[model samples]
Structure formats: structure tokens, C-alpha cells
Target chain A: MKKLTKDDLQAIKQEELKKETANWIKVGLSTCGIAAGAQDIYDFLVEEVKKRNLGVSIQRCGCAGMCYAEPLIEVKVEGMPKVFYGKVNKETAMKIVEKHIGGKILVNDHIYDIRSSQ
Target chain B: MQQKRILIKDTDLKKDRTRDFYTAFLTEIQDKKLEEKVQLVRVSDIGIYGKGLTVRVLPENFLYCDVETGDISRIVSESVVEGRPIEALLHKPDDKQLRLVLRNCGLVDPESIDDYIKHDGYQAIATILEKMTPEKVIEEMKISELRGRGGAGFPTWLKWKLTRAVEADQKYVICNGDEGDPGAYMDRSVLEGDPHSVIEGMMIAAYVIGATKGFFYIRAEYPLAIERVNRAVTQAHEYGLLGENILGSSFKLDIEIRLGAGAFVCGEETALISSVEGKRGYPRPRPPYPSVKGLWGKPTVINNVETLANIPLIMLKGGKWFSSIGTEKSKGSKVFALTGKVKNSGLIEVPMGTTLKEIVFEIGGGGIAGKKVKAVQTGGPSGGVIPEDFINAPVGYESLQKLGSIMGSGGMIVMNEDDCMVDIAKFYLRFCVDESCGKCAPCRIGGTQLLHLLEKISEGKGEIEDLDRLRRISRAMQKAALCGLGQTAPNPVLSTLRYFEDEYKAHIVEKKCPAGRCAGLFHFSIIEEKCKRCGLCFRNCPVQAVSGNRDQGYLIFEEKCINCGRCFEVCKFEAVSRG
Candidate 1:
């Protein structure tokens, strides 16, 4: 591999980021998030996504700075609004997949954040 | 497709008229019959403060401040419904938070070494090893004026310089991840969110101080942080960044992970060193500072996790650029774990001298459940509470210390009106007492004694002379304690007494806790007029203390009442009252 310049590095980062769009499920994998049962949620989401063969790209990220409402799952799908569901356990993870992914409907009570596209 | 989206926020912190604005906007949309075209929604938070009625239009990102009901039509016509900014109401130039230490946090995949490399992470170490000398690295640090974020604000360059000056065949650099400050999780976030940044910093420190070995003394409580760090270290070793010839250079440094048993005093430098050396975690004296004679009688440089995370960026960008962001004395951004009764309880990184009010009310979205903010406690057990009046005080090392608090590891806990001053003091004092290593008499005995006095006051058995006893013992601890642990342990108590002495006097003289927090000082009673002859209070009392029929109404029995406030919580009619 050749040593890359700063511009090349930035370009690669941009290209990689471009791949992350449309339907995606991001689990908060940081310490605070994990302590609040994020790992179980992450595993459940992965298993559910695999079992159903859902068109969602399941990924992991660090905390979004809300520890009080951990086990956070951020879902973003094209046409629909981007939403963050907090206090998501295994049951909620399955609901996220069933309702949000399969049914194409947003789940209630668990949605702590909503980012609608106009 | 719709090209415009408007975000409306009532910027007045005094009162939330956002609902009024929301109603008016909805009515205007309905009146104009533009419901299908334009969408209006109520938001939880908008990042502006004290400027009445703020509206931000998306796609164009045009901000309109100080908007009124009358201006809503123009905003609807020009900006929202039409897609152009009302020039008169437009507010431009929003300066955002510049993140340095937390740059990669929440951005990169922590488990991936390739992801870290893709961000130009360890390139700083490679560059340093190839081009820069140890002297030049230290000189760059001095130019940056980088201080320890772990508290005390000691110059980072000086610590490295002192360790570098020592003629030793073996030297050590330790990353102090033993973060036990109440409400503080900045270090844990950094360690778990972006483990590579800290590892990169440790590598730079090793290259500068010529240390062959490094250790991360993280608390055992943060299992995920430990797991991430362990994974990161193993990844770094595999990448040739650790072990022999790191980054394909002659510099060889091996890093290890050590879990602290979660003793608060172990965060202190001397005690941390002792704990790492397999001895009882206790603080010894200074002057033979860790930089000079540390870690098994070898010169050592221990940097906080956040402090180490800043090193890569400082080295990459010129020192002058890094120093220019913060205040005159305090340079660079500080990551504060903003907790307590704030609406948004999490990590916030603001520049130095950014006022406490802005961090609390603005960034943290004010007090929890829209309660009036009373005070903010910083530095955890070693810090003092700043009253609402001093909310405008800038957040820095000197400013916080001058206001009877030290900037101890950036734990900013916002307290609302419901928190009693005396009770708050007692809470922190008791934390220090529980965490005290019991090695020194002043710390062990004085902290215990002060905690006892505070307990007595909160329990309604205190006298005025107890105040004098607290002061005398605080002075003794401040003067005679072995290290930072004992020396600063009495801060929360002393600072609270200094500011809210009247609250203490009230507890002792009037037998009342003004905040209704102290259990012994507070009395729970059922107001007869407010009681609706409901048995809710009677059924809800854990001890069955509220004894009376629904016809006569429930009354709290003074002898049997535990002051648990269960009845108060259960009563929906506001029948139960505490005073």
C-alpha cells in the first residue's frame, strides 16, 4: 500500500461515508450505552435483520451524549423521517424491525428524537 | 418536492411561549389552508438562548430571531410557505462548538483500526518518529500550553520536561483513566468512543519521554471502556504501533491495561501510583512529584485520558492554532459531563470561558422538567456549588477556583430548586468520606468528623457550634492532608457553607429544610382542604403511616411516618404537603 496524502485520506473518508445512506440502524456501543443494555439490543437487531433479510444496514457508533436514555437506536430510511429510539431493549429492537423496517411505520413511545425531511 | 422547512423556537429562557407560537403557526396554516404544503412540528430543543422567538429555516438554513406573532405571517409568506428569508428578522453567524479532544468520538468505529487510520490518526506518531525529535515535541507542547484536563491544570509540557530531564534507563507514561467524579463520564466516553486517540497520545508521550512501557489505569466500573481499550491496544500492537519498532521506527513502547477497583482516592497521582504498584491506594507527600520520582522510584508522566486524546491534534495542527481557541489562561476545549437536573444530561465540549449559564441553560436545555435552576456543582466531591446568580461566571480553571470550586475533571452537575444546599453539601462530603483511603489522620478522621456533623445537621440534631467545628476541621484537612484527595475533599462542604450559611442556620434553629430534602427536618402532612376524601395516600404509604378513614380524610401519623414522601408522590390531588 502506498502512503496517502491528506487530500486522498479525506476523499476516502467522504467516499466511505457516502455508502451509509437510506435505511440504516445505528446502535450506541459506548460504555454508557452498553451499560444500559445496548449490546443485547445490538445483537437482537442484527439477528432480526438477518432472519428477515431486511433492507436495513445495521451499524454501530459512539454515544450521542444522552446517557440517561441509553440503549439508543438511530434509524434512518429514505422518504421516512430519521428517528432515535431510546431505552430500547430486545423487545423494542424486534418492534423497531417489525414496525419501522417491515411495516414502514414509525414506532410510538420509544421515539425520543425525530428528524423529518421536508 | 418541498424545498423549505421552518424550525420555530421561543428563545426566551424566562418562560416557554413556544406552545403559543406553535398554536399561532398552526392556526395561520389552517386559516391560509396551507396544511398540505407546509408542515409544522413542536421540537424538544433548539440550540439558541434568551433571544425571543427564534425560527430557523432549513435547506437554506436561514435563522430568524426575536420573531413575533405578527411577523409569523411574513415568515410564512417569505420564508416558510415561499422560500426566502425575511431580511429584517434574519440572524446570521452562529459560532459552533469546536471539538478537538472529542473529534473522533461518535464519528469513528472504535473496534476498527483501519477506520482510525483512515482518519489520519496514528500519522502524527509516524511523523514524530520520522521527523521531530523528543526536544521538539516537548517544545511544541510548551507552545500549545496544554494543561492536564484531569484537574489542577498543571502544564503538560513541564511534566514531560521533568521526566525527560531525569537520567534513567527506564521511564514510564501512564494514562489516568480512573475517572470516579460524580456525574463525570468524559474520560469514559473518550476511552470507549475513540480509544485510538488516547492510544495515539500515549505513543506520542512515549516518543517524547523515551518510555519503553505505558499503562492505562481505567476503573473496573467501565467494562465497555476497558474492553474497547484492550481491543485498541491489541490492534495497535498488531499494526506495529506498539511493541518493537512502532510504526516502522526504532522507537519501541509496550502498553498494558490495568483496571482500578473504583476507589475515588486512587484518582489522586500518588495514590494511583501506589495502587498500580500493588500497595494500598494512599496518597504520599509531593515535591518528589511523579514527574521526578514516580512509579517504583522511576520518573513517570501520567496524563489523563482526555489530556492524552488532545496530543495527536496538538501535534498535527500548529500549537498556536490549538492555543487560540480558548481563553487567555485556559487553552483548547474542555469536555464536560453535564448531568444532574438538566434536560439534556450528557457530554458537552465547550471552549474555555464559555459561561456556565450557556453550558447549562443553552447547551443542556436548562433544568429538568422546566424547573428553575438553583445552582451548578462542578468538580464533583472536590468542587463547590455555584449559585444561580453566578451562572454567568466563565468556566475555566481560575474562574471556578475563585468561586470556591476547582475545575476537577469537568463534571458540571446542574442543580434545580428542589435540591437543598445543606443536603447537597452532605452528599459530596459523605462521598469523600466513603472514598477516603484512611492512610492519613487528617483525611480519614477529619472527613469522617465533618460528614458526621453534616449528617447531624441534615437529621435535625445540629447546633450552631457544629458550624465552627466544620470550619476548624476543614482548615486542618486543607493544611495537613497528604495529597489532592484529602486537601480538596472538604471543598463542597466549605464552599456551600460559605455561600448558603443561612440554610445551615435554618436547619439548626428553625428545624426546617427549605428545599424539603432533609428527611428529619421535613414534615409531611395532608392538607384537609385539598384532600378529596380519597384513600390514595393511605394505600400508597409504604409503612401504612397515613392512618384515617376516607370520610375524615387521611392524616400522617408523626411517630410512624418515615418521611419517605411516598404519599406525596401518590396523591394526585395535591393533598399531601411537605415542609
Candidate 2:
């Protein structure tokens, strides 16, 4: 935790960007997302990932603004399109892990928004 | 084989043909035996509204709108099976949204400074500390033409220049996060979703104004925003971005958080300055605006959360580049908390001067639950409503002001046909009345008087003269009221009266609520033919308004009915009617 100078910023950013070793799931943890039971989904994903000994890392992010379909979770498993699953719950969370992660095919009816802009 | 994907959704509001369309597409895929190679998924929404069924084929990014069942087989063979798009069915959509202020929001982890840094977070401040002068910073801001997103649309660079011109040793900068507008949570979302960007904006301001101390004024209502901001500030301090010699430069600045006590008036700059100084949030007249004398009699620059969030980007990218997006007067982008009666109620960032129609229909996916959008209320209580006709007007400071509304804090509540204009005016006026500090007589009394007149109108007791009375009181409140709260409190009433004066006349002269929102003016009656005698309306009635059971069929007696509209909601047969 050193006081970062201007020179260290680029190196730090580059290092952090390169640190992505495994697939990750970012759950919307903002107030709106949290209110829509995103916390439960995040906890479920973490427990399930650990229980199943999966290589997926569950992390927290803020609201993506599409709040109508919350408990929103974005899955970025290898070889699958990065997409957002809305109205997510424990059941949907399990399906996402079992289907999108293990099976490599996107779960139907749960995809709320695809990252088309990116 | 190349992996192909197709995303489909039924864009029709009345019926969901997605299941039928899904089966047809599945049958086509199975017939071709391309089930594994081509994965067709049913999505909840394909981001396209009202163009019938929408099908988007992936990898090629081909979209086909209004696809019938006959066209599905062709779509599968050409787009899905062969990876070639049908030229006639290939629909091109004009996406009218552009995200700049919300770039890192929801994308980056708010608590992690590293995540923000990777997204080119504090690069603006680092660049400023290394090269740009205070004057140069202000010049860049002026070039961007970024007015404050905090309702009033005051130019950001001018505020800085004014504060910088005043020769004060102990200058302060405040970030106005006390967003008290109803139906607006853009500030809270930004603070919670991307705390470091705002910090970077504030740091850039501190550098520009040479301010030694800064305050982040967030309302106590947003605990998570407060927590994230507190973390962001602590992170900035640890990284030498705040609290003495920031970024190894000679400039030294410190930022601290001040919690607002949930007062709406605190959103005003003067009152916000007073609140930060530990006083009751009462606004004083401007002679000495915050730019000249603010935060303990020292020169200060207060910026709204969105305005500050835009600063870091403006500093990183050149000001000319930023100004190229919006209209002549308003520049860059605006983030709106699109709520109330919209299908996709969420945070949407569009370029400034984007039409309200584009926002409601294109980005928001139109009105919620098959209802037509009657009006769009922007700028919260202090601002006015833009009726359906004027929704095509570009949403800038001047354009919205011309349409009798201001872009107040980017809270655009898309109202449906069921919402009464008079009722909406009364709701905003009531909020103003309740949140009024009661410092001045015109605001204190005139606001209450306006509310009373509106209340009278809604209850079928209003006279034609009461409309004139409302106008008189609104004018007085606008002119004589001490602060923005009282001055702008009459906007919703005045604007509604301007556009929907016929409705007001109907309320006063005809004694009939056109939208049927005002309960006293309307009564409940059951249409006998439409009534299935399901006892739903009878069971849902709070009072014993209907005596008949399922065998006899229910009847709403005019005497006992309270006009609550509960029966209308519960009746699946559309039996319960109100007029």
C-alpha cells in the first residue's frame, strides 16, 4: 500500500489487467441490485463454485442500470458469449453454473441483455 | 463447424409469441439437424420494441425484425445455418444512446481503485498535475461547454472561474451529491457504482481552483453510496491523490464527507453550503453566490455528481472532442434515471439533446404494460412535465426549458395515459410543500396556497377562478420566494396548466376527471355484460359496496362506492368500470 506516483499507475493497471487467469462472474452488488436479491445469487454462485471445485471466480460490481431484471449477473465463461442474466435467483444461479459454465451452452429465457455495445 | 447463435424475442406488447416462435425455430433447426452447431436462445428482451418479432443472429451481428413463421426457415438457413444474412429482412436499428459519464459505472467495481485505474480513472488528475495550468483547466471546461447537470444548467467552467478569480487563501470545493428530487437516483447510482471517477473529477476541480479542502455532500439516505465514497476517499488519500502533495505535485488537497440530513432544499447550492457548515438547510438570496463566498466565507466551487463524473473524461479526452457530441448549447452526454411506467426502468445515458421520444421508446423500450405514454415528467418537483406531443423536443437545458421543463437532475419519469395531469401537478406541489424550509412567506404561504388550490381542483370543488388564482400564486412564488425551492415549486403546476389547461377546465367546469385519477370526481359502476360474476370485484371491495354474490352477480352501489378502483384492478372480466 505505497503512495502511487504517476509512473506507477500504468504499470499497476497493466499488471491488474493481465492478472485475469480464470473465468469470472460479476454480480451487480449496488443498492438496486442488492434490493433485487443479487446478494443471494452472489453467495450461491460462490458456494456452488467452491462445492463443485470450479475454476470460476465470483466478484461484485455495481448496477448496470437495467434494474427491472435484477438480481442481475454477468457470466464470462470461456468460449461463451458474455451476457447478462436478469431476474436471477438461486435456481437460475445453479442453472447458469451447470449450463453456461459446465455445459458451454447459454441457458434459455434467462438472458436479459447481451453486451452488444462492447 | 463454426458455432452460430440466434437471439429471439417477441416485441409485441399484447401477446408473447416467443414460445410459438421458439418452437418453430427449434423445429426448423431440428429439420436441418443443426441443433448443436446452431444454438437458438429465447431472450427476455432483445432491446427492440414494437417492431413485431426480432431475431438477432450472432457472430455476424445481423438483425431481422418483423420475422413471420414462414420467414423463420429462411432466417435459419441463411443467417443461422449458412452464416449469410437475408438482405431484405436485415433491419438496421438506430441506437441513440451513448454512455460517457456512466462508462465505468456498473462495469468497474466501485470499491476497487485498481479497477477504476485500469479503466483510465485518475489519469485526468495525473495529467492535470503534470501539465495543465488552472486557467488551462478552466479553458478546457469552457470548451466542453458542460453546464451543471444539477437542474439549473449553470456552466461548470464559469463557476470555477468565478471561484478562482476570488483571491482567498482557504478555498473549498464541494461535490453536490444531495440529490433530493423524487424519482431521481442518478447521483446515488453514480456515487455507488463509480466512486473513484467522481473523486477524480473533484481532484481535477481542486487542482483547477487551487482549493486545499473539499467536501463530498451525500444525503444520509444513500448508505451504500456513503460507504463506497468513504472507501474511495480513503483509497485516494492512501495513493497520494488527496491530503497533501497529490500526485507528487506541489498542490495539496484533502477531501472529507459531510452527510445531509435528508432535506430537499440542501440540493440548492447556498443551502448545501449552509448544511455543510452544520446549519439548517435554508437557502439564502444570491448576491454572493457560492462561487464568490462559499463554505465558511471562503471562495468555493460546488459541482453536481454527474457534472463531476464528466470532468475526468473531459480532462482525459480533449474538450473539443467532448463538445462534438451534444447540441450547440448543451454538450457531452446526460444520464437519466428512467423510471415510472417505463418497461425497462433503469439508468440510461444518452448524448445531450437526444429527443425524449428516443429515450422512452428506443432506450427505455416504451411505456410499461401495454399502456400508451401520455406525458414524460422531467426535472422532478422543481421542473415541469413534457406532454406526449413535445417528447420529440431535444432534451437540453434550453430545449427542455422551452418545452416548459428543465433537465433537473436527469429524473425522467415516463407517465402513462392513466396518470392525471392535475394529479401529477398536485403530487409535485405536495412534495415541494412538505420539503419547503418555510424561510420565506411567498414560498412558505404561496406553496401551501397553490397546493390547496390544486387539492380543490382534484376534489371537484374548484371554480374557474381558482385556475387564475393558481397562476397568480405560482407567479408570486417564482418571483418573491427566497430560493430555488419556492421559485421553481410552481413549475409543475404552471407547465401542466399551460399544456393541459383543457384538462384543468374539465376538472373545474365539467366536474369530471378526464383521466379518472381523482377519486372524488369519479364513481364505480359495473357493466352487467362484462361482469362474469366471479366475485373477484366483490371480494376485493374494501367496504361492503356490492351486496350480490356469485349467483346473483355483483353490483357496485353508487352510494357505498369509495371510487378506490380496487375492484377495477381485481376484475379479470373488465366488469368493474369507473367514470
The numbered model that scores best in lDDT is: 2
Give candidate 1 misplaced runs (Cα > 4 Å): A1-25, A35-56, A68-118, B1-3, B6-42, B49-55, B65-73, B91-96
Sequence-dependent TM-score of model 2? 0.98
lDDT of 2 by residue, B364-401 (tens): 98887788998999999989989998888998999999
Scored by TM-score, the top model is: 2
After TM-score superposition, what is the CA distance of residue B456 in candidate 1 from its true location, in Å? 2.3
lDDT of 1 by residue, B1-579 (tens): 363445665656434477777789889878888777655644434566667887776656677889888988888877776677778988874444567788887667888876787777777887888789999999999999989999989999999988999989899999999999988999988998899999999999988988999999999999888999999998877656788866556889999988899899899988899989999887888889988889999999999999999999999997888899788899999999998898778887889989998888777778876689988999999889998889999988998899998888989999887899999988888898899888889999999999999999989999999999999999999999987888999999888998899999999999889888999988899899888978988988889898989677778998999888888888899888898
lDDT against the true structure, each candidate: 0.84, 0.89
Off by over 4 Å in 2: A116-118, B13-16, B557-560
